[model samples]
Target chain A: MIYRIRTIAALTIREAARRRLLAALVGITVAMVGLSAWGFDRLAHGGALTSGESTLALPQSLILFMFMFSFVVALSASAIASPSVASEIESGVLMTVVTRPIRRGEVIIGKWLGLAALLAGYAAAVSVLEMGVVDWVSGYLPPNPVLTTVYLFAEGLLLLTLALLLSTRMSTLAAGVVGIALFGAAWLAGVVGFLGTTFGIGALRTIGRISRVVLPTDGLWHGAIYYLEPPSLLRAHSLGQNENPFFTRSPPSWVYLAWVGVWFVAVLGAAILSFDRREI
Target chain B: MWQASSAESDGLVAAGGVPQATAPGEGAATTGSPRPSVSPAIHTLGLHKRYRRTVAVKSLSVSVGRGEIFGFLGPNGAGKTTVIKMLLGLVKPTAGEAMVLGAPVGDRRTRRRIGYLPEMFRFQPWLTAAEVLRLHCRLLELPRPSWEQSISESLETVGLAERAGDRVAGFSKGMQQRLGLGVALLGGPALVFLDEPTSALDPVGRHHVRQITRDLRERGVTVFLNTHLLAEAEQLCDRVAVLDKGAVVASGSLSELLGRHSRVRLKLSAAPAGWTTGLSAFGAWRTEGEWTTVEGVDPDAIADLVNLIVAGGGRVEAVIPEHQNLEERFLELLQEK
Candidate 1:
């Protein structure tokens, strides 16, 4: 059984590595990384800012680029993970393998491990590259670079797991679209709730809290941002009215971290259950 | 030898086909009995399945003896694939019990001893043919030491040895189908369920599949074949079960099924005035332009009829015996139903 699961994992990874879409993704990633590097170089050498503002602007600008990169991660993970299970089920590619002596749980776990490994590699590469570019241009690095990279990978994984669960019952296209849409909505609600909290608007704050409970994707992204920005920048954003969507007032609480873990497991468990009952 | 290894794992097969642990030697002991009657390789009791309101299969009971090539014949929407799926544990039965090699349906250990090729399926196109076989070898838990040789032999058997290194993405539909067959034969399974194994193949590929299936049977492997091509079934099946709307309408050995509708066409140089009338006593007779057609004639009575013709002073020139082929019998069965 262990051998079977391992073989499946290896095949899954091998197949994923060969996808044309993955090549396209890497191409776009390279272009984005190069473009960001150029943009930061210009900001440093173009002489557009005072030294005092540059201190705050450097981290601010880096966080903004990080937001785009994180969204890209979420999108890429959904694109791959959504079709990994749902399309196979629809196309009947899963029939032969599942009929073997291996358990269904093994298949699910093997697939998850394969895709997670791929996404983890992607997240780490982009985060590290962007950090290097930032340091070269502005001599500024986030206080906790490793923590920020970990958080970004966690955010991508959370969305990927949700997409996988949806794929068990929905079409691949539907799962991908819905997964990304929920991720976007949660982030929007989090921003609106931050404004509500800053201005003491009770109803708006409630909406943000509710969205976080419904989907923790935005919460995870917020944690990544909290680690990526300097403490001085965070304090500045807090003292002023919360105008920046990328700014984090406080680190994610332990209870929130616990909830994220619970949510991830619950979604993965539900996916396995749905896949078990599903008829090909 | 393969049976012994499989049966050595546990107790006697559970009586009702529900999966349970078996004593290691009970399988061998039960099979070794001299009673002449033994457990079927594939057996189902009132198996049924429904997709919402669509009744895919209903009350399907069948038994395929060991080492026999059992063809499952059915038209479109006749539930042939559904039955195969249920037996292979790919689809759950709605309300009946099924057992394969005396193990309950979907039994993990039993699956190790079984091979299946679905009616419609696709392999991961990125993997080479050799890699696909390797993956299945691991899944089937074939001995690690023999993996390399087993993969090579399976590929060679399917006429795919030279293309083993080629990625499946470059394969034609027929080649892919052949690869699917190779995958099914990977572990030297005790029983193989082939659903439309020849659907995408050209004549040559189909012939190879038939030969492979026959070879498996010769080696004491039970083959449960599902196909719509009547001639294929007629040529290969030892016994057959015809399914219609999820039910077995007719089933028996090929000879038995065809025997009931046998006919003979006789051509004579000349006939006596009352010869047609006299021929009626031997069997049902009708006169076509240059022949006397005998319907439902017994094989032994053919000689007697020819001798009678000579006694009646008529010269018998030709006697052509025709047994109903599967197509005709299948049509008649459908019409009767």
Candidate 2:
């Protein structure tokens, strides 16, 4: 079983590469990173500001860039992993593979591992490159770059798990659409919660808490935001910057992180079970 | 209940039209010595499946002995694929028991000895032919050292050895089919289920598939084949079962079915009055001048028929066996259902 799962994982990764999904994601990321580096150079040396002034501006702007990358990661993860299981079942590939000695759970786990690795690798590489360029241009790096990237990778895998679960019982397009929509909804609720915290409203705060518990993308995304805080943002928040949507107040608690882990395992288990019971 | 009908099918396989299979391992059991009995490669008792109001398979009880080419014939929407899926553990049967390779269906260990080629015959298009085979080698858990050799031999057997390096995206329909066969042939499984293995192939490809199937049988591998091409089944199958409305309508050895439905034509030179009435004991008879055509008797009974005529003071000029076409026989059986 171990050998079978490893083989399946390797084959899936090879499939993603062969289909050029990995290449496309990498290409778009490189273009984005290059553009960001050029923008940072202009801000620092193109008469817009001094290096010190630009470094001061880097925190919020860097958060914005990371936010964009998060969206890219989420979308890519949804599109790629959503179709992995559903399309194979649709095209009759599952019919052939499952007849072997391998179990259905192995296919699900293998696909999950393969896709998780791809999305995580993409998320980490792009985060590191973007942060590196910002650091090179202005000597300003996020205080917790590694944790931020890890959170970002976790966010992508979270969406991937949900999308893969939906794929077990739905069409590829349906699963992707539903996954992206939920991500949007969760993030919106998180913003609402942030507003509630700013205005001392308990109902909206509870809504955010419930939404995050329901689906942890926004919760994890907020943690990524918290970790991506540059020293300038930290000083500003220390002097009171709680009203900013980009300014997360603190890292996710152990309870929320535990919930995310539980949610991931549960959804993945459901996907495997659904696939095992499916007639195809 | 499972092995009752499978290990011994004397009750399920009554005389006449209902299919009767050879006892499992009867072929290898040399006469005068106790037979080394091996479980049938596939056994199902009252296997049934239903989806809401749709009944896919109903009471599909059949047994396939080892090393035999058993053809599963059915029309579209007759649940042929469903039965195959159930037997392969891809889909669970609603009710009944199925054993493959001496264990219940869906046994992962037992699956190591079984191979299946689905009707769709799809493989990962991104993988090369050799990569596809190697992936299955890993899935089947074949020895790591034998992976390359197995891929080479399987590709050569399926006539895709030269294209082993090409990705499936570039393969033609015929090439894909041969590659599918190559994938199925990996690991040297004890039993293989081939669903329309030749559906996408041309004449030469079909012939090649036939030869490969025969060779597998020669190697003591049981092949459960599902095909719409009756002509192909006629040429390849050792025994067959025809399914209609998700039930076994007719099944038996190819020769038994063809012979049982054959028309025995006899030309008489002498005479006994009302000899045509005696034909009723055999089957319906039609007389044309001195020639009489008899239908629906075992072909082996033709000799007894000749003796009857000779004892009745009638001289027999000729006895010719005109076996019915399997295609026609299947059509008649389905229409009867």
Candidate 3:
């Protein structure tokens, strides 16, 4: 089983490394980080917010930048993962491996581990780079960098797993589109739930909760970002005040975190089972 | 329920003991033996497969002995691939049973003893030829010490050792096919299924592959070869099965199949124009200029024809025994249904 996993992982890494998508991902991530630094530098000069005020506001900007970086990383990771298995099957490369002594489930798991390793590496590098820039400009950094990085890596891993599962039944293009759409919808739903809870809208809050439970990408990201920022950022604003949701106090609860782990295992298990039964 | 029968069959010590027998019109004796049995390298009974509405394989049954080179021949889309896939457990049969190495098809244990080279093989373009072989070795759990040596030797066997470090992306179609075969032979599998193993090769490349296949056979490896290239099958196969439409049309040793549909062509010189009148007793006779052809030649007819031609003042040039080629037999079987 371990050998099968290693083989699949090696194959996946080789394939993913060859795609033009990885280069595009690196370019976009580096550009985003550079752009964020430039924007912060400009905001630093404006007297509208003092150095101390901007320093405090650094967490919000860092969280927002991380969110954007996550989007880029998730999109690229999912796009590559979506085709990694399906295209191999279509082109007959999978036949070379699957017909060997290895089990089908082992192939799927190995691929998952390989893609996860890649996404984890990307998530860690981008998060640390962006956090470093935020610290340099505003002298502010997250108290729990390790926890925040783990959460980010977990979010990417979850998205990759979902993309792999979808790829088993759908084409690569369709899987990528659906995976990204679900990621956006999950985040949107979580926001709606957050607003409903704060404004006493019970039904809307229930919808948000259900959406996050259904697809935990957004829920996990929100929790990770919230954990990285200061508690003061989440203080409720007045009716006329305009504030980003990054300033909301009600981050994902412990129950939602537990459910996210459960969701991860469930989706990954389903992906392996579906791949096992698939004809290749 | 299906699982129980497979387990029972696996426990049976008799070699090739499935109750289903080959169709009986050919008069070929069933070769059954009893000593501990190499355990039915491949077995299928009533194996039916369909794509939507068209049945690709219907009630196909065959059992291959261990360490035997079994040839599977058929026309295009004649269920040869369908049968091979069923044995590999790649495609599940709609109805029927397929067993490999005494285990259910697709079972990991059975697969460990089997290797496969699919027809129209395509490898991961990004992987080097050596990486591809090593990857397969890793999956097959061969020891690390043997992995590199086996990879090199397998490539050398396929004549791709020089291109071992090169990515498959730049490989020609024939080169890719060779590398695919190299991967299949990496771990020294006891049973190997090769579908058109030499389909896209130059004559020299084909020769090399045939030699490798022969070498495998000599090493006591059972080979189940599916090919439309009749000449290659004739050269290497010990026993063959011909499939038409979705069923086995005819099967047996080359000599046995030839015996059932024998033909003799006689080349005569200075034969009279009215030779056709005297040759009607033979099964089927045609005269193209000086070459008179007679098919399904019986010994009595040959003697009579020689006597008539000699008595009629025509000298007998040469009597040639024209055996039925696989292509002719294949067509005959197709027309039979």
Candidate 4:
């Protein structure tokens, strides 16, 4: 089983590497890195009088930019994970491999590992480049940088797992589209939940909680925001008083993080089960 | 239920030796041998599959002997592929059981020793032929040391060695088909399921495939071949099953199926008026000019014809026994339904 999983993982990575989409994703990452570098350098050295207010706003601004990159990670994971399984099922390419000695669970896990590695590398590389640029120009860094980077990857992983579950039951296009739509809807619900909390509306607050439970991408991103925001910025604009979608008032609790892990395992288990029972 | 019918009808097996069960290993047991009998390579007992309202395979039971090339013949929608899938563990049977290589169907360990080339298979286009073999080797968990030599030999077997470095995306349909064959032959599996293995090949390639199949059998491998081409089956198969409407309509040795309906053509001179009446013992006879034909003449009836022709003062110019090819036998069987 171990050998089969490893073989599948290695082949999956090789397959992804040979695709044009990987090249496109790499190019997009490079352009985003370059753009962030130039933008930060201009902000730092423009001599528009380096004021205390701008320095104070640095963490908030950086979180906003990283949030954009997190969206890229989520989109990339959704794009790759769905088609990885669904297209093979549709095209009959998986018939030879699945009929071998390996268990269906091994195939699913191997694929998950491959996609996880790819998404993790992308998240780490982009986060490091963006953080390095912010530090080089403004000499400001977010608190708990490592934790922030992990949270961002967790967001991508959540989407990846969700997309895989969808692929077991639907077409590639339907899985991809539904995955991204859910991600977007969850983020909007999270924002609305913040508004409800501020305005004392119970129904709206419950909507956000339910959406997070259904799809944890937004919840994971909020955890990332909470980790990436500066201490002063977080203290000044307590989440309820702030309108910024990129900031979190408090770090997600230990229980929530545990649920994220549980959510991942449950969904991944469901995917393996569905795929095993599927006709092809 | 079906095995009982086969046992009763198989007078030759019972009369020639012992009463034999079609089930594998039973023949050896009835002969009082406990020396670890080699079971038939494939054995199915009333195997069946259904997709919602439609029954894909219904009560299929056949045993293929080891080292024999077993052909599965069926028309469109006759469930040949479904039966293959069930035996290979690619699909689950709705009822009954199948055993391949003495293990239950869908047994993962047994699958390790079996190779398959599905109809209309397409390898990953990005991988070169060598890389594809490597991937399959790894997937099959064949030891690392054996893969390099195996890949080379397999590619050479399918005549794809020169194109090993070329990506499958650039391959023609025939080349891809050859590569698929190479994949199936890799790791020296004990049994190979080849579905329409020659569907896309030219005549030469088809000949190469047939030769490879024969070579595999020579090396003690069992091949369960599913094909629409009866000539291929007739040339290679030791036994065959014809499936229609998801049921086994007919199955036996090629000669057994075709010989039951044999026809003999006779050209005679020196007329005897009552010769035609004597030939009635050989089933139905038709005469035109000096040529006479007898349809459905069994082996016993042929002797009567020769004796009557010689004793009646008729000159037997020539007697030709006509054998029906597989295509004709297949069509005749289908029409019988």
Candidate 5:
């Protein structure tokens, strides 16, 4: 089993590393980070709001940068993770490996490990670069930059896993689009839920709670971003607000985290079952 | 045990539908041999595979023997590739089961003893030919010491030794196919499945692959080849199964199937105005221009016809028995179905 996993991981990493999509992803990430740095520089120097003002100052800038970063990260990671296995199956490369003395679950797990590793590495590198720029220009840093980086990386990994699961049953194009759509919708629903909680709107809160449960990409991002940014920033813009009765904290409670883990396993299990039945 | 051997021999002859002349000391050949006496290397019982609503393989059952090169012949979309995939466990059958070496297919242990080369094989573009082979060796759990030598030997076998270091992306389509073949053979599997292995090759390359396949057979490998190239099948296959519309239309030793539909043709210097009447005893005879054609005729009857024609003052040109070529036989089977 270990040997099969290693082989599957090696194959996935080698194939993905050679794809033109990876290069494009890296380039886009760098450009996004660079653009964020430039925009933050102008905002810091303009002095429209004092650095001490949490709503319109450093906190807002940090939240805005993280939100933008998450989109790019999700986009790139989803793009890579989505096609990594499906394209292989379509091209007959998977046939070569799958027909060997390896189990189907081992193949899927190997690909998941490899893509997760890639997402983690990419998220770390880009987050570090963005932190460096923020420190260089704003002369302020988040209290727990490492924690924030870890959270962002974990969110990226989770999104990638979702994309991989979708990929097993759908075309690469459709999987990517659906993955991105789910990510966007979940985040939007979370935001709506937060507003409903703050404004005491019951129906909106229920809708947000259900969407977050269905697709936890947004919930994960919220937990990660809240953990990464300054407490003052999170408090000022109502950013840390969790509207759902199920998750009243900015980051999920232990129970919610456990539920998320269960969700991952269940979705992945379904994906593997679907793939095993596929005709190839 | 010796009695078991005799029973197995009888079973083989019966299952194969052709009797073999027992050679001296052949009974001793069964002892201490890696080959099994009972179960065939591969067996499918009414296997059916469907894609969505379309049936790709329907109730196809066949068995391949150890150390035999079994060619699966069919036109495009005739389930030849589907059956091979099912045997290799790359595709699941909608109904029935495929057994490899007496174990159910899709079983990991069964797959360990099998190798496969898919049609239009695609490899990781960044990998060199040697890297790809080494990776396969690693996956197959070949010993560390054997990796380098096996990689080199596999490349050498495929005539790609000189280009071992070259990235597969830089190689031509035919080169990639050859590399795929090398990967399949690297593990030294006892049973190999090759789908259209020579479909993309030139005539010379095709000949090279055919020779390699024959070499594998000589080394006691069971080869299941799926190809539309009947001529190559005729040359390389000991036995063949012709599939049409998701069913096996005909199967058995090449000679047995071809011999069943024998044709005899005669060329005459003078058109024997009534050759049909003269050759009526030779079975159904037809005159197409200057040639007289007879079907279902024995060799002795053909010789008799020649003698009678010469004795009847009709000059005999040439008496040639027109054997059914693989292509002709394939078409006839397809049309018959």
Candidate 6:
């Protein structure tokens, strides 16, 4: 059983590699990392700022960069996974595969594992490389880098699961559009909730909370943003208010994390069930 | 060895008028007793499918014995593909039951022993031919030690041994079809379902598929073939079922279906003007000039026909016997339906 799944995952990875999509993703991500590193170096050495000021502000800048990285990861997950099954089925590629001794659920889980592994690995490596660059250039490193990467990876997995679920029932383009649109809506709601908390508006706060509960991408992004804040900003943000979208005041509650876990399983299960019932 | 018809194979065959094929060594053991396994390779009773109000298939019943080449014939909307899908468990049957390889269709163990080449014959374009074979080997749960040999043998069988390292994107439609056939033949499946197995092939490729199918039958493997090429079916099938409009319009061993209506064309001189009148007992006869044509003459009674004409005060000039080929019978059946 494990052999079949491992072989399928390996095949998926090989397909991605041979198609050069992996290469394109790597190239674009590397260029982004290089440009960000240069910008950080300019902030430290070429900008009008004292050493202490640059040090204090650089982690906030890194948080902003990390936010961009998180978006990139979410988008990648949607693009890579949304069409994975739907297109194969549409083209009759899965005809021979499903008729084999393997079950439909195995195919879905194996593909999910392949994409999750690729996306999570990409998220972790990019986060570490960007943090190291920030620390080297401006001498400012965020606390809990490992925890921050975990959140980003989980966020990618979450989006990937949604994309996969949609792939079972929709076309590649439709699934990707819906997946990414939901992610954007959740993030916008999170920002609105932050503003609502600052202005004492209850309705916007409820919308944000409900969106996070429904999708969890924004909630996971908040956890990642919280871990990227420097201690100084955390103090100031707490004193003033949670007015910024790039930095957060506290980590997500364990209950919310637990709910995210449940949500992950429910969506993955639905994907399997939907694919199982679908006439291929 | 080609009988031009399979009707005689029915007496020995125990399922749906298709004779059972003993395995390589089972013939020796069969002299003293019945074959150990009596289950037909495929057995279906009242199978059906529906998409909303549209009925894709209905009241489909068929039986195929082990080691026989069963041809499934049909028109464009005849539900042939749907039947194959239901038998392979790719589509859910709305009603009735079908058993394949001694178990229910879509059963895991049964599927493991089955191979399928779908009509489209597509694969991931990025993978090489050899990689595709290897992927199937793993999917088939073959041992690690056997994977290399199995992949090599399959590639060799499909004549893709030289192109095994090439990506599928570089393959032509014919090559992709050969590759699909090679994949279906892998793991030595006991039953293989081939849908339009030669639709994209050239003469050489079609010949290769025919040879491979014959080889599969010799190994006591049951093959269920679906093709629009009636000539190919005439040359390959032991028994055939003609489907039209989601139902089996005609079915039996080829000889049983085709042999019942064979034709005989005759040329005679010095025959009486009414000599052909009593020929109705022989068959449906038509006379034009010196020629008299008869249809539906049984192969066994053709000699009686010539004797009757000779006794009717005619000097027989020439007697030409023409058996109704599958294409003719297929068209006739469709037109009648």
lDDT of 3: 0.76
| Ordered list by DockQ, greatest first | 2, 1, 6, 4, 3, 5
Q: Report the C-alpha lDDT of model 5 over A1-280, residue by residue, as the tens digit.
A: 8887988787777776776556777787789878878877877886676656623366556766787787777887788888877877888778888887777888888888888777777778877888888879777676777777776776777778888888888889988999998888888888788788778899988878898788877777767666555656545547654434222236667887788889889877877787787767
Best by lDDT: 6
TM-score for candidate 4 (chain B)? 0.87
Q: Count the backbone clashes (under 3 Å) in each candidate.
A: 5, 0, 0, 0, 0, 2
**lDDT of each structure?**
0.82, 0.83, 0.76, 0.82, 0.77, 0.84
Stretches of candidate 4 exceeding 4 Å from the true structure:
A47-50, A239-244, B1-37, B268-290, B305-317
Between the candidate structures 3 and 4, which one is better when assessed by TM-score?
4
Choose 1 or 6, whichever is better by lDDT: 6
Encode model 2's per-residue lDDT on B1-337: one tens digit a residue.
2233444443224112233334334422322242314557777767889989988888787778778898989898888888899998888898977667666678787787888888875788888999889888888889899999999999989988888999898999788888888888888888999999999999999999999999999999999999889999999998888887788888788877777787789999987776554668887888899898888767778898888888778899999888899998999888887
Residue pairs whose backbone atoms clash in candidate 1: B10-B22, B10-B23, B10-B24, B11-B22, B11-B23
DockQ for every model comes to 0.76, 0.79, 0.67, 0.70, 0.62, 0.72
Off by over 4 Å in 1: A20-22, A198-201, A240-244, B1-38, B267-286, B297-319
| CA lDDT for candidate 5 | 0.77
> How big is the positional error of residue A81 in model 1, measured in Å on the Cα after superposition?
0.2
How well is each residue in B1-337 modelled by candidate 1, as lDDT tens digits?
1233233222123223332323334433444442212556866666889889998887776667788898889898899998888887778888877667876777787788788888788888888999989888889888899999999999999999999999988999889888888899888888999998999999988898999998998999989999999989988898888888877788778887888677889899888776654687667778887798887777778888888888888888999998878898899889888
RMSD of each: 5.0, 4.8, 5.6, 4.4, 5.0, 5.2
**Reference interface contacts recovered per candidate:** 0.91, 0.91, 0.79, 0.79, 0.81, 0.85
Cα lDDT, model 1, residue B195:
93
| Residue range B1-337, candidate 4, lDDT tens digits | 1243343234112111233334444433322432212556766767889999999988776777777898989898899998898887778899866667766667686677888998867888989999999998988888899999999999999999999999998998889888888988888888999999999999999999999999999998889999989999999998888888898778778888898778898889877777676677776888899998988789557877877888988888898989878898899889988
What TM-score does each prediction get for chain A alone? 0.95, 0.95, 0.90, 0.95, 0.89, 0.96
Give per-model TM-scores.
0.90, 0.89, 0.87, 0.90, 0.88, 0.90
* Candidate 3 lDDT tens digits, B120-190: 65887777888878777777788899888898899988889899999899999899889888878877788
Chain B TM-score, candidates in order: 0.82, 0.83, 0.81, 0.87, 0.84, 0.86
What digit string (tens of lDDT, one per residue) describes model 5 on residues B70-132?
888889989888888888777778887656665567767667678899996698878999988
Off by over 4 Å in 2: A49-56, A198-202, A238-244, B1-37, B265-319
